[model samples]
Target: MTDTTAFDWRSFLLNWSGEWADSLPGGETRSEGDEDARRARWLGFPPASEERIAAAEERLGRRMPPSYREFLKVSDGWRHAGGFVWLLAGTEDAHWHDNESGLADMFEEHLDEDAGPEERQEADIWRRGLQLDVESDITHVLMDPEDVDENGEWAVYTWASWRAAPPERHADFLAFMRDMYREFHSLRAHRRDGEPEFANDTTRKLDAQVAQARSAALRGDWERAGKELDEAKGYGRPRAAGLGDQIRRLLGQTYMVYFEGLVTDPRYAPELLPPLVAEHAAHSYRDDSTLTFHLRGAGEDLVSLAYATLERVRAGTYRYTAAGPFGTAVERARELARWGGTDEAWRTLIDALPLWEPLGPDHLAPLGWVADPVLGPLLTPERGRELLSTPRGGRTGEAPRPTAGLDPGGLAWLAEPDPGDNPTSYRFVLVEGAAPEELPERLADGNGGGDGDGTVLNERLTLWEARRRLLHGRREFSSYDDRALVAVGRAGSGWSFAFDGDPAAFDRRRFVSPAASASAGSDTRAVVVWSGLRARHGEPFFHLSVARGGAEQYAFTYADEEVRSRGRIPQALDPSRFFGDGEDGAEAERSLLEAVAGEFGVRLPRHAIVNGRLHTFTTRSWTRPPGDGETYAVIHLRGEADRPADDDRTADDDRTADDGQGSR
Candidate 1:
């Protein structure tokens, strides 16, 4: 709420002069000489005497609101009350809205049938309100005597004929005047020459507040600084708003594209203006609304230079000179940009932003430097997205390194010929305090003890042999075979590891079922990590699940670029920190794997997964038609017999079988 009692009307309306119209409706006509005379008076008429106010109120058969009466005492009338209002009525000229505009019948006709009581009442009040403005751009400013508050202030409303909406209601006349004052400042700020520097008492007081706020911001007292700046902005201080935006950017609250202050100081303009101009230019190209660059006189030369540099950046010929403490990081980013790795280059700079030192007392951060000649063109749409999505806080330290768990990239060979081809599409499960040999039995237990039939065979074999068997089955039996080869081994940290080659094994009811049930015992836990390299054909996916004492403690899945989670995932394992826009699928998977490995401190030996022997088994379950009802069966096979017949083997199967020979 505005402090209407303390508002200095003269100080608030200081220097209020602009071009005036030739004439006003129901008011005196103004010639060029009369307009010049009014401009000299600062658009304020002499204060109305108490006798004049009394006569006007007696004619209207009502007393005026306290705020409006107070305003008339300060000035009989005002010109250019806001951007739209042209002339405000003096006490003698004021009249009832119902007797003049005749808008009640039209409003009643257009009112919706489902209009609420408040809306209907508002329309009714407007019909009898006192009209204040004599001329406007299809705008009406009214005060309702029937809606007086405890302070004897009437509610004020402003409606525009072209808006096709209800009139906006203000708490009182003071509030309406405050809004108009703010509008005046807002419009003034956008002028090509920018807002004029005001030396009035109000501006001096607001400037002191802004200085105090800046000191508070420097001291890291953001809350206090924000409150002070907000108060100053409410008073329509342009400098306060600009500094407030700077603080928001520092706190990662907003990514401000345009700044308010003129950057004419030679000390800061060279370092700041390029990025401002580039960002403004980039935004102008992408959006229909173009922003004005508030550069005037000597500052105009800097803008011209910035535009020329931007042209070179777009042509891929711009070079950035590394400087200051972050020179090495800037050089690295420059190199990355040269190769068309725009996202990576931008990320590199973003990572180094926290370490930037101010060139002088006025500098904020490296945020504006993102449009440095070398880096400006790298601000592609995807790079801009990455910038916006980057986490709020500055980087804590270098990314965590994997000490225990398998690098997800290391396992890519299981699905593709090389780790670089695509992210390996496989599921890796870790169960604590469980032996490798017990995995198959636990899985069989979860599968209802294998159909209660003797034909459900289980035999131990090497990991390589199991891989051959799975491949042979898929090629010779069914390309979409439901069979899964579960290779059990010992992972670091006393946790048992199970590697399932099937892409769909991440399903809770499939391979994860046994681990979930097995870890149900006292003091046991299970963790599963999966990556689906669907980016080769479509969108990529990643999933993580943690279970303890038979209950799922955490479950997270990132599919189709959206995240879904149940329970709390550890902060260290958050996938968002590792993911980036336009990131390669394999690189993204690798980064996620590293985070999980660092969090859990567990690792799987690469040799064991690809070549070494381990207790491996093939598990499959399906339903068959029965004469009476449905018959279900489970097949748990192991050893060389699990391999498909030689006559039915494909060329890939022959290769896999040959690879398994020495390991078995």
Candidate 2:
């Protein structure tokens, strides 16, 4: 998609070659010069001192894991020190597509909930693949000459690294690790009062030695680092759990950096960078390094830069669509009008809106995430379009309201059918010409037939007209609410209602509403469903439409039972909260009770009850009003849990331990 007038697709492609640097021979090696520079740049960096490692180990009072020792050997070449990897959240399943060769089968299998055990296992493995993909979260630190010890015994030290935590916070993580180790050691004993001492005597000695060694290493002492590591291991301790793996990965990075430096080709860095960094970061749950380290190693590669830019743009777009403030304001405004709101809060929200000109020349995009019908007045149509074109972050979009307004005297209808008994019910009717004039045509003719004016279309047209008149002059004010419109349907046992299609079902045929059905003069199943002309039993309803070109049959697809049974309705539009309780049938009993208690201005008692039962409703539609007239209410729940016994004693013990650590 083009972003600005200056954007040209062809030019972009031509310029993209610079992004990849130079391709390696047989796609395995980079050119000589770039490789040499990268290696030199990383190797020139200083390695972590042995004394620092020793001191850190001393602080933890445990022998660090082998992996961790390996990591320290190459810590100097750590590429990235930024928190870029750690901040990336959420799984990347949506990125999969049909075009992926090996992954396509896996993707399709995952879509099938009823797939056999083998298929399910395959899908699970696929999920785990995505979950464990090194690129998902990682930091890379290349090894170099400076990473080795004075004796030429190479040690790993991060030089250029990905998956590095925020520079400021890295030290904090060390402290956190140390503290957690102490806690783990405390839990080893498992006394009657709970873990007063270390049950694993070996681990206790290792911890003390490692902590001291690390503390000293942090001060740039090398001689003591080896001594501490050796002494801690002598205590017959197993490897440290969390810290060990990281150390090992770091060591690997150091070795690779040294290896690459020895090699002349620059492509080696790029080739090795992506996978190595990815692997390291993956094992550590660090995501930021995946991007930062690669970028750093890549240097002037324009293709990589473009990709990075694209990622940034995409992230920006996502935030713009999903969590931006403007989108929130729009929704808030809608709620304000539906559920009564203080004028001051409303005005404050409006004033907070960033300035945007309506149809103005400025090229600014609308903030999609934050915009809603409630905040529509603050946004211009142009701005909205701009926001739609922006890239997405790792977040999803919120629901948008329907464009249509509410009509008064509106005859809202819902239909449900029982699967075991009767299956079909009247959904809606589309009549031609006029409502009254079209009714007689079907009944009088031997065949259910219609002329231009006598057709069932007339009846639906008449219904639409009547409803519009009742809802006339209803200017858009409130947000459109899909939740409130569900109850309006007449439901039986089996059939449920939906719009467009449902998402969770394995079969698209079950819920998809063919696009052609909604067009004028169309004759698809949607038209049939909307028309309420025929009541077919359980064999799923189908109809052919000729709106676009040639006619094609459309089917009433069954969606997942959950979506069909109880679609999520936002509580903001529930009428009983605004209108008095008992205004509806026995269903309004809770509202009635709440209203009665509210009159005395006293809070009601809160209780916890577990109602372990599952229920389903074959719903069609709900009785929700348009933005112009609907009301809403906000309900808040609050409570607190009592503390466990011996809380004071526990606190005292923890405090004493902390104090002892500080003194040491």
Candidate 3:
């Protein structure tokens, strides 16, 4: 039971699929056509019973290599395209194929009779057969079981009726298959989509530039912003679905309105400065008496000098009463300009005063509710209240309220299997910028982690650590697809295909579920289903797949390897159980939500339920206080919804109404 470093050949060839062929040029992949037949043919024939393989060996005198023998039981022969391999040969056919008798002498004699020194040399090296199939394809690449490698496995060499150059070698049949499929997919994809250099360093540079441009635009600098975007425009996306292209697209599409007209107005208007600041910008400077507000405003000098002026005012005694110098406290702060501040400086000071109770009336006036037209609309009523009532804004020991959105940690989702499943491998879906080592052998059930080259060998994340990592958007996956997760209990399992028994019986317990009918209103959101593998029938295949639809529907799916649609994954979570879709459901649902809130420090927002699943339109957050008694720095789970929808809006409306605070 020692760990095997070799690529697991028997499992791969057994599970070898032609599904990758669809990734070739024709966009409409595996449609209702010859594609299925082609896939079956390319995958090779079904298993050759043990008796059949034994007959072939008995007739051959010599026993077959263990790898080759094992392969025979999986499939007697590749249906049509096992890289030009044919059926196994008995002794007589082997003798002829190997040229074991007088074939070489005969060829040499024929060359002598037709007599030429060069031709005679060409005939000198007679080819001896290894595991020769009964029939050869147009070209033949033979697995030489007799010739072993450093690990005592066989070597592979190509042979044919005609010779052009020396044959290429592979370490073993499994290694040979790996090379074959690598080329096969490359050729297929090229045939389908035209060759392009994808996922390279050049694309990375463009991504970096696009991200920079996005940052500049967010800070209200259009000129500096457009320059970076313009430089990155030359590189068109490598592939449409890849993360780089998606990132570039998002950068160009979002936040344009914020920068559209701001460049012309260099002056920081009170209406504009307040909205430009980030949520993390506020810092309790020195002590609670003075707070630092960082701004990503119009100009460096304008912003810096404005910041200094505010620091001076903060240094001195400042008061904003109902009756100050002018009609309001904000206008009174404007009076600072007469003493040395610019108009922009005055605006900066006023913009930040909404929450500065030390300088304003004794009321928690969050700026998101500012009366100014420009500031009011952008600062949604829901967000404004969040600034005041959310746990992130609350004092120590006070819980943070949940905001609804996507999982900001990452779009990828993973599931913890039932203890009874005894699952050994875990899968993560829709992750970006991840390498093999980060996920390690954890990603697959078999010995070789994906390609079977067996180089992947690091195990980094503990189950909860993995959950915390993905909840925060870290890259545990290599792709940008954020909609799947799978874990397997046995070796060589994947998505359930042509499986047996009742599918619903295999769902994992204790996972997050969607609500049935939300009290908020008529709610239509996404649902997730976890599919357990029926491991014994074929290859090991366990999957948690998303029933794709809107952004809300596809919040997260727990998956480990490449995903496949194997019919509908059974719904494990009933929204009714958690959302009171029917009567007698709310008390338990609310209790569970409350418990989860207590642990995560977030109140679960409005949500619906389906079956056994819990789906809340709320962001979960946990604050990690600094070690050694430090409290200023804390970590929280941030939400990043895929898109804004009615589910989010409905939830917000319900919260605002229930709390009896109209935007705080």
Strongest candidate by lDDT = 1
Candidate 3 lDDT, 107-167, residue by residue in tens: 5766657667545533433445454455556455555545665555566655455655545
- Against the true structure, what is each candidate's TM-score? 0.46, 0.16, 0.24
Clashing pairs in 1: 404-602, 404-603, 405-602, 405-603, 520-550
Worst 10 residues of 3 by lDDT: 604-613
For candidate 3, give the lDDT of residue 626.
19
Pairing residues by index, what is the TM-score of model 3?
0.24
Mark the regions of model 3 whose C-alpha exceeds 4 Å error after superposition.
Answer: 1-11, 20-42, 79-96, 100-126, 131-137, 150-152, 160-163, 192-664
Whole-structure CA lDDT of model 2: 0.27
lDDT computed for candidate 1 = 0.58
Scored by lDDT, model 3 comes in at 0.33
Could you give the C-alpha RMSD of every candidate to the true structure, in order shown?
Answer: 17.5, 30.4, 30.8
lDDT of 2 by residue, 1-664 (tens): 2112233422322222221122112234543543543434331123347676666556544333333343344332222122222111111111212122243353464466676754443333322221111121233211122222333322221111243321111112222222223333333322333322322334555777666554443222323644565444333233222122212222232332222220112333322233233333335443454444334433456335334433433222211221255446545544432211223223434333332221111112222222121222222343332232222222123323222211111112122122332213322222222222222332222122112222222211112222343235432211111111010111111111121111111222222222232222433212222212113423222221112221223222222211121222224323324234223222232342233223212121010000000011112111222222223222222235623222222222323211121111
